[model samples]
Target: MSDAPTTTESNPYLRDPDVQLMLRAKAGDDAAFSELVANYQSRLVSILSNLVYSQETAEDLAQDVFMRIYRSKNGYQPTAKFSTWMFRIANNLASNARRSAGRRKEVQMAGGDSSGVQTGNAGEYLVKEKSALMPARQLDKSEMQGIVLSAMEGLNERQKMAVLLHKFEDMSYADIAETMELTVPAVKSLLTRARENLRTQLESYFK
Candidate 1:
């Protein structure tokens, strides 16, 4: 009943993974670079979409990320994980975009709720929030989504980035700290507070 092509959860580069590919790519293996792009393109786009709305802008930024990677291949070291490095660049680009522009409004199919992600309705129930969020009312799927995004939007720049990377990008505290140029404990504390704040804001609706 669907026309979409089936996608497999395969990454051929996993044998050598991203870092190895980058090394070969630096040695002028065009195929290796292409493989790296194929491996990470989806993740890059998904991460960017969480921050920006325009697909065009996301594509441009994604290309720039890769370009920087290629340019820096000679000096690159695997001190941090490949993903951490990739997202560090992504976070920088995203932060700069936010500073230069206003909020981007677009429906995101990534990171809001998937794979144990909280839902607006609990266990297949359709609950609707009262008009204007009247006290003690329920929240539907869209309302819940809006509430999460809005609550996240209100966080200070660093907190927002912390939440986005931790909760959505699934980065570790160490990786996040490295990306944001913060201490590990600081990243942990920030995420703990961000989660608590979001939970407090959405508790009534969630239950």
Candidate 2:
């Protein structure tokens, strides 16, 4: 869906060992498929946990991602890195889950959850505390993390995802663009805005 120029050089992923493993799995190698699953299981869960804000739901979604990949293995190609393809699926799955959750109009918010993400209800409380947080230097590590999480909660879903992918995953603009189905310029703009929002939300902490 990106309007940006697509890469014309041979995809670097074609030489990736993981892509080769996936190709083997595509050829009906069950063990190869299992290896791929094992390799990505933890990573998928980690990313999805941040996206959905629930460890349990993240695990379920990760399983769903693998299932979809397995079912579509027949059509698999090495046009991109295995990780890129995997995260693209994760990003889409997370977006769909958010939309579905939004339709219900009621979401439970739990504090001190294993996942650092905050749900809609959680964010409701955060808006009330926007006056100011204690200075960042005085807070402990846990408190700082909470502040960051609270700041992240203020971002809209797309901005949050863009921040997570760019900051946590260390993905390039092009990589993030591919994963989120946005143009490179859009991805850049999203991250810029997200960072500004984060700074504004955490202004007290930064000082």
Candidate 3:
């Protein structure tokens, strides 16, 4: 789907082909389930990897996501877009894993291409790079990634997840709210606070 924002006249969720494919899977089409898994595997792993911070764990969690979906196919419903539903499941699973493990120490973000980076196209990086107060030496990609990832780690889990869904997925506020089990206003508030926290944390990089 085009990431471009379009009019809501057409309910994008209902219009998504993946939703139809999921419905087919719900109807006991094993091949449809395989196709759904194929279509989402990489994307799911990418998103989960950032959340969980381990490609190996992300792959395992993604497999678990598919397993859950497959097991509950009989009760599948289309209340939201297939991707949103899938991601909601992913978010919950990640949150549970984090909570279960307890007190995770902060780690530097690594791995993944720019496309999978949750920070969004280099907009924030450009702003920092062009700042008058920036150090004379240009920040390389690794430095930028470190700074961005550090700032992201400063956010609360919900704030971080909200930023990820908003920036990486290009999801509408409504869709994000649906995926995160939040109200539209709550999503907006979460993002506002998240951006403020990031800006504060990254202040040294800016003017």
Q: What local lDDT does model 2 show for residue 25?
A: 92
User: Taking the tens digit of each residue's C-alpha lDDT, what string does model 1 give over 94-180?
Assistant: 777655443221223433422311212221221222333335433455556566666665566688778877776788888899888
| Model 2, CA-based lDDT | 0.74
Best by lDDT: 3
Residues 31-90, candidate 2: write the lDDT tens digits. Answer: 998999998888778667666666667888889899998998888867777878888999
Let me know the TM-score candidate 3 reaches against the reference structure.
Answer: 0.73
Q: Which pairs in model 1 have colliding backbones?
A: none
Candidate 3 residue pairs in clash (backbone atoms < 3 Å): none
Name the better of 2 and 3 by lDDT: 3
Instruction: List the global CA lDDT of all models.
Output: 0.66, 0.74, 0.75
- By summed lDDT, the worst window of 10 consecutive residues in model 2 runs over 1-10
Runs in model 2 deviating more than 4 A are 1-11, 106-139
